[model samples]
Target: MLFNSYSFLFAFLPLLLVSWRLAQGYGPTGLALVLLAFSTVFYGLWGLPFLIMLAVILGMNYAFALALAAPEPEQAQPAATTEAGSEGEAEAQAKTESACMCGSRKQGGCRFRLSRKSLLGVALVLNLLPLLWFKYSAFLAQNLAALLHVQWHFTSPGLPLGISFYTFIQIAWLVSVYRGQVTPQGFTRHALFSACFPYVISGPIVRYEQMGQQFDALSPITAENLAKGFTLFTIGMVKKVLLADSIALYADSVFNAAEKAFPLSGGEAWLGSLCYTFQLYFDFSGYTDMAVGLALMLGLKLPENFDSPYKSTGIVDFWRRWHITLSSWLRDFLYIPLGGNRQGRFMQYRNLFLTMLIGGAWHGAGWTFIVWGALHGSMLSINHFFRACIKGKTLERILALAPLRLCSILFTFFCINLCWVVFRALTIEGAGRMYKAMFAGPFTREAAGLSATTDGLAGFAAMVARWLPNNYIQGWIPFALLLVSFFVVWALPNSHEVLHGRRDGSHPRLGWRPTAAWATGLAVMAFLTLILVSRKATFLYFQF
Candidate 1:
């Protein structure tokens, strides 16, 4: 059920859209049910066993949510877009120490004798069990065994697709339920939030409250929504199919070679790593555009995930701009819960470090991810410390200077790219190999043609082998694309900007409209993307 797959493009999505439109006439419930049913089918197609796992996980969470639910305490409104801004109340008093969701809200007929805090603790443990068993058990056991000097080996199961995202999203929902900030909407709403197909596989990783309302008062399907949806979807498809996948040829070639301990010329290493940097951004953010566009077609809005992250001037800024959903989730769930910045500067740095370490581990069962996380956590702590040391007008003036700002952006990009090398590598050793090559590998033909030596496989890399006619041409394409990626990322308005964009955050860029010209352009782009659908490449984040 990949958004880029032929069956999904021609059959499933179109059929779902028609069905969804017809169902909308019946009311929101009809729309929700149709979506939920199709979403169920979508996940099932990935693997029925995982679908069962998802269903069980969803059932348990819904039950826990209901158990945790008490009458919604009076509040202004469930936090909206500003959820990102205020997620970390690390200032304190946020975590309900004694009162759990169900403990005090409905004292009558309380099923559990446990207090709210205890119930939440238990529920949280239960909620994380599947994720732990599915994703981390082997890694944790292997480490524990090594630490204890034992010959113990642990076998782990295949990670269910979207479990990381599902776990995080539900944790947010469950926590919100426990916080008594939101009432349990219903079973269908619960399913819809957790299982809606758009964000189901690869997500911007939305929260419960963020989407609850979108499914409730879903506006009737309209032509304007359709136009915007198609336009955005087409743009995103171009990014993924035309750019990201194409760029992956270089990324995969370089990294795969490094993993096998092959000698990488400095140019090969950087070409691959930088290509990957752009590839990942375009892949995930491109997926975000398609996800948001799809939801919009159904009159739902997904939170924005990226905003020109490569343009970030600092590590903290990079985190804020990149993977915005996961960053907020970490702030709310991990950092704040660890006392955030409440205790003191020392504790704040400690919390930030620990939050990133966990965030990194969430990506995969490899030391590469932990190191990646640790590097980021350390950088973040340093970033915060520097901010703490710098003060008012001096800092402002330094920031205002164009030259210094450019240096800052470049410095930040360099650090991020280095970290991404660790993140993308298959192992810590492989990462070291990449770093060695990036820093000081031979630049000669003896390196055996960067990508050619890697094992036989057909992918974008294979496509590249055919598309690139000569060795010289092969080397130049990535550099050229990198230049274009840099320009697109730093100069042009992003998809959001193109729609409701301000290029400099103050001036409007050209935007889409419900006109024939826009419609025709989108149609042509869609047709081109459809031609690439036969490749059936999965989005990179789908593995996470």
Candidate 2:
């Protein structure tokens, strides 16, 4: 059920769009149900067992929300009126009315709020249980067995697709309900929010408070929105099929060779790592564009996930741009609750470290991810410390220098590239091997004993034996493509700018407009994407 797949492009999406439009005539509730039913079918495509698990989780959360939203019985004498006689009584009555208006309870008010808080806590744990069991149980068990020196055996449960994303969404929803930030919707609307297929697999992680009103106000499909969505989807398809997948060939070759204990020359190591860095960026960001486009087609607006992260001048800036939604989610739900920056500097650093550590582990059940998270966390702490050293006038003067800014950007990108090696490796040992080769191994072919290698068809056999090494591409073709990707990422406007027809915030660039010429271009991109879709590569974030 990948959005890039033929069945989704030619069959599921077309049929679903048609059915959704027709259902709009039946009114909002009917349209919502149609979406919910379609989302159910989409989820079921992954597996019935996981679908059933999702349904149960949704039902429990809905029930908990209903309990949280239940109204209390009115007092017999009406406390406000009864206490209106004396001045002190009137003051107390005013406070009571204020509390009620603010959606809080006073004395003799609903006991349901207390009970609901407990229920919400239980619901959060219950929802996370499936994610823990499926995603992390094997890692935990194996580690425990090694520590205890036991020969215990355990079979891993199949991971449900999008469990990490949906689980976070559900947790956010439950917390919002408990905090009275979100108004409870009917089962149909809630179900649609929980299972919306566009972002279910790889998400921008939309919050209920942000999107609830959009869900309620279902506008009729318009030509403008449809065109915008199609354009975004086309652009995303080109990024994924044409760019990301192509780079993945070189990256996979080198990494897979390393995994098989092959010694890599320094050139091969760096080439592979750089290829992977761009591959991951385009892969995840490209998927996000497609998701946002799909939601737009259905008349829903999702939050932007990326903002030219590579242009960031520091680790802190990088986090702000890369995976914007997830970073915000972690800040609001995890960091803020743990006292955030309101606490002392030491505590703030501690919170930052812990948040990233957990965030890394959430990506997958591996120590490599943990170390990757720790590296970023440490860099962020150091960044903050460095900022503190040049505060006020000095900071402003330093930032005004363009060369310094460029150097910072380059340094930050290099640090990020090193982290990606850890993130992409199959194991920590593989990561070590790759890093050793990247930093210390010989760079020249003569030094590495490959100076006699031939060119053209004659060399194909040797290159094939070396896992079809990246050098097989010949000439400047690969470098040309890499240059093109850099131009698109750093020089060209992003998808958001193109959609909005103007620069939005820090994204200062030109945008696309509806025109006959643009339509023809989109059609060609679509055709090229279709030709490449036969390769059927899954989006990178799908593993999480």
Candidate 3:
């Protein structure tokens, strides 16, 4: 069911589009039903059991939302039909209306609010249960076993695809319903919202409010949307096939070496880390592009996700740019509720730490992820403190200089790169080995077990001899590719900029336009991506 797969591009999408176009004449409801049926088929492709789970969750949430909506009290008084004859009469009428409004508010406050909150809590727990069992059971069991000094043997259940994403989406919906931010759409629209194939897997973590109107107004596909969608999809395809997968070769080799406890030179460590940094960016961002494109083709608009995160000068800025949806979700749902800087300096820091800790755990069931989250949390807290300290100081003026700004950007990128090591590693020990090699002395390959022949320059030379013959060109290629990636990332206009007609001030180049020439170029890019799609790699975020 990967969008990159030929079966999807050639078969599923085409069939669905044709069916949708055919159904458009039948009206929006018919078109929506078509979409819902196709979405169900898509989910069913993963596994019938999981599809059943999704259906039950959707049904349960829909039922809860309906119940929550039902108890909404009606207006207590009807409007008066006769017009006021005098000023005194008008004032008396206004007072009566005000009193009625106040009484209605009191009634809703006493009954509706408490019931809605209880229903939302129930829905949240029910929706999250599957995610908890499938995603975290192993991590919990192992930790509990260690603490109690008992060997706990339990077979972990397989995690259903997109469980984390869909669960979060539903939770957001429940909360919105409780707060009266979203009205309960019927089962059909709610189901479609939850299971839209483009986002059901890896997502921008869409909200019901964002897509509910579009679902009701589902329109026929248009040439403008088609061109824009195709262009976006092509750009994403090139990024994934040409850039991410190509860099992944080098990144995989180095990470695999580290996993095997192979000794790494400092040069190799940095190069590999850099490759992985770009690899992850292109991989996840590329997926987001395809998702957005696919949604656009269907006349639906998904929220933007990535916004050139590497260019960020601070950790907070980086989070705002990278995984924009997830960050916003955590802020609104977790951080704000936890008193998000409103309480005091200490509470703000505590909230930030806890939010990131939960955010990291949401990615996977591993201590590495927890530590990675902690790293960002700690840095963000320090960043906030630094900002506070510099608010009215001469140091603030110094940091605003161009060179300082560039240094800040580089420093932020470097910190992010280091964090990615923990995020990508198989274990904390593996990440530790990589970090040690990354910071080791230039000629100290011996400590990593690369050479045992001598203690001095001879051992270094022997290590060099062993590495040079095999990796000389291999090493250079990744560095060269890394340079190209850096140029593209820092210089070229991103997909959003190009598609939206914004110029890249830093490096103006050819921009995307819907012309015959551009169309041909897009076709060629699509062809090349199709050729590479046989490699059949899934997106990195799919695991989460």
Candidate 4:
């Protein structure tokens, strides 16, 4: 069941919370078992076969963790602390990256009996094998068939829910064992680490090094945490149910038109693109908020996945902010493993391109996803090159100017918008159609389907009229919500910032509390979101 579903919000979470609280007195193992059991139930609800797949993978990964190395108190540390490098990549950052990819077999990693390196390789493959089979086997086979100029077909059993997410989480765990960044915990804890109900489906991906201790020491479900967690969940529910889903109508229409080879006016293409741009943020951001919030209620903290990515001034800056966990995973496990910025600038650029190409492919098994990754990879390489050319103080001065900073932010956002069109497309040809409409379409007022209005509000109204009937008063909702989203993303403090309060002078009074007013506001949002749960609209990132 989805976290936003009626069964989850009204039944599962309440029962789990009560059981978790009661089990706390029974000790850590008992409490952990309660969570693991609930997590199994939650995932098993999806399908028994998939749950079996998860269980088998978790069992194998845990065995690998135990086999690699027992927990060494002296060696254990957060994986992020393990000499993950940076120099020209000052803008690149992540919450948890791997150190296992470092060190050669001969010169380093001498601490092995029964060929630990070989075992680690086996474990990594074991984790990846299912993912490759279920998610990409058909994509791979089809491509191979095309290359051989023969008719060949491969049938896929379809993707298991959260297979991609849990695969990465488990890979990070097994590697952490090799790196001695974490001691393998008990089987129950290891299973629960990746299968935690709140984040199991869509994640701000957690690492064992960080979450291991939290699993062992789950804090009690207190009123303070309850208030905060529920407050955040309510906020996220509204964002997904109300804003993201509402705006998706506009985006879906335009994208559907483009996919069918329908010629769109420039205004229609841009309007669709912009709507989806906002929709993606609100959807993912909303899910992140809900995941973090729910985990908090269980007294386990998941790292922040986003930090106002829309405001990023450079591609590098955007990576650091958006999908913080996955980027960090790619950085530590993939990027650095391939020799990050350690080599000269050219190798760094090559690594950046390869890293992003792989990153894009990680999203899906389509050529369109590969193109998305390639675009970001290219952008990242160029961003690094530009930064390298400018000296320290000169770069600082350039960044310090408000006008340049604003321009940088706008430019980065614009580039991201173009790339997102490809990211959202059904196929390469469809993306080209949208791109043509966006860039190469006629500029004349009549030709481009202009409203001839300079007023921003009027323009949005006119834009909506193209797809929506003028007499449909409700047609204005998406545009109205999109305008509200602008204020929310750029101006308002995020869920984290609201809970923690801003570091800057602004929003001095923005902290969340258990006061009556806060409860009332959250109650209203929850009620509204609950009523709209009939849509059963899955979070967008769930597909990835």
In model 3, the worst 10-residue window by lDDT is 105-114
Superposed by TM-score, candidate 2 places the C-alpha of residue 521 at a distance from the truth, in angstroms, of: 1.1
Full candidate order by TM-score, most accurate first = 3, 2, 4, 1
Q: Encode model 2's per-residue lDDT on 321-398: one tens digit a residue.
A: 999999999999888988898878889888888889988999999999999999988888889877877778677687
lDDT of 4 by residue, 494-536 (tens): 8878887765745536678768888888888888988898898
> Each model's number of backbone clashes?
2, 0, 0, 0
lDDT winner between 3 and 4, please give it: 3
Q: Give the TM-score of candidate 3.
A: 0.87
Residue pairs in steric clash, candidate 3? none
TM-score for each model: 0.85, 0.87, 0.87, 0.86
State the lDDT at 176 in candidate 2. Answer: 85
- In terms of lDDT, model 4 sits at 0.82
Q: What is the alpha-carbon lDDT for the whole of candidate 1?
A: 0.81
TM-score of 2: 0.87
Better of 3 and 4 by TM-score: 3
lDDT scores of the candidates, listed in order: 0.81, 0.82, 0.84, 0.82
Residue 304 accuracy (lDDT) in model 1: 88
Ranking by lDDT: 3, 2, 4, 1
